[model samples]
Target: MEKKTDVMSIRVNEKIKEKISKEADSKNMTVNTLVNQIITNHVEEGTVFQDLDFTSVRKQLLKKLFNSMPKEEVTKMAGTMCKEFFKDTTMYLYGKYDLESTVRTLESWFNSSNIPFKEIKSEDSIKMVIRHRLGSNWAMYFETMIKAVLEELEVKTDSYVKTIDSFSFRAYY
Candidate 1:
């Protein structure tokens, strides 16, 4: 027996409905069937790929390749690239760079990206600590990125970073 489908009534512009109908005709499917398939795919794809998001997989794989090389060399090369990249970003153009604000923004970013971190902040310094998971290298990239941003903003900071058992850093601004 075929699965029963439910009806969903929506109000779309006539032109939009016509476009959908045309697309459905091209695919040899009814408008209803096409819309159903599109909506179903959109809803199910994320659940299917939840823990295996593309960025996570790509970074993990790249880290394996990167680990074979000299880390100090990578640290220097990537830090220079980051500085160049930030020098061209809109953030650098706007030029309202504050250490406290940047720290808060980075904290929010790490939290939203599901990267676990422990941080301590004070009037002149910020410390960030993160686990060096089996296939992720967050230390060098983050340290360089932060340093580059500071340089672009002309904020005087002394940065110390170490990536041993875990990635940890202290930045005095």
Candidate 2:
């Protein structure tokens, strides 16, 4: 138990004082402590600095840049990322230009990592093939998986998505 000595009193609406006292009682806190905390918070918020410091602003910009790269870099990064992401799984890609090059790079990396892959022809207008050892419903799986990977790489390729044929898994040898 502590003894109270010097006390300061301030006039307030009777109803407000009663409400404050009730809240303090509910929280098992002294009314003076609760009022002090409220006043401190109010003062601090009222006097909050509005300026954004250069270091903090610069850090935010760098964070945004790392999170998102230029479009060309993202395309190249997507190829690198696909290889890393599907290292243990089978994957296949078919196209003529950039997509073909990207997939070839990934395929080489996969081969070097001992992840087996096989390319099979598809009867579609788009150059397409099935991969090896992808399990079931692999077409849908691969499409979604690849899209997600590209998104992470910050590469947008929805317009060219129709160029991809059926993506699936075959034998795993």
- Name the 10 consecutive residues with the lowest summed lDDT in model 1: 46-55
Over 4 Å off, model 1: 1-54, 84-95, 132-138, 151-161
Tell me the deviation in Å of residue 60 in model 1.
3.3
- For residues 41-90, write the lDDT of model 2, one tens digit per residue: 44532232221111223434533553455545554554565445443222
Question: Looking at candidate 2, what is the lDDT of residue 82?
Answer: 43
**How much is 79 displaced in model 1, in angstroms?**
2.0
Query: Which candidate leads the pack in lDDT?
Result: 1
Model 1, position 48: C-alpha lDDT score: 32
RMSD of 2: 23.0
Please state the error at residue 53 of candidate 1 in Å.
14
Could you tell me how far off, in angstroms, the CA of residue 13 lies in candidate 2 after the best superposition? 0.4
- Tell me the alpha-carbon RMSD of every candidate: 14.4, 23.0
Which ten residues in a row are the worst by lDDT in model 2?
Answer: 46-55
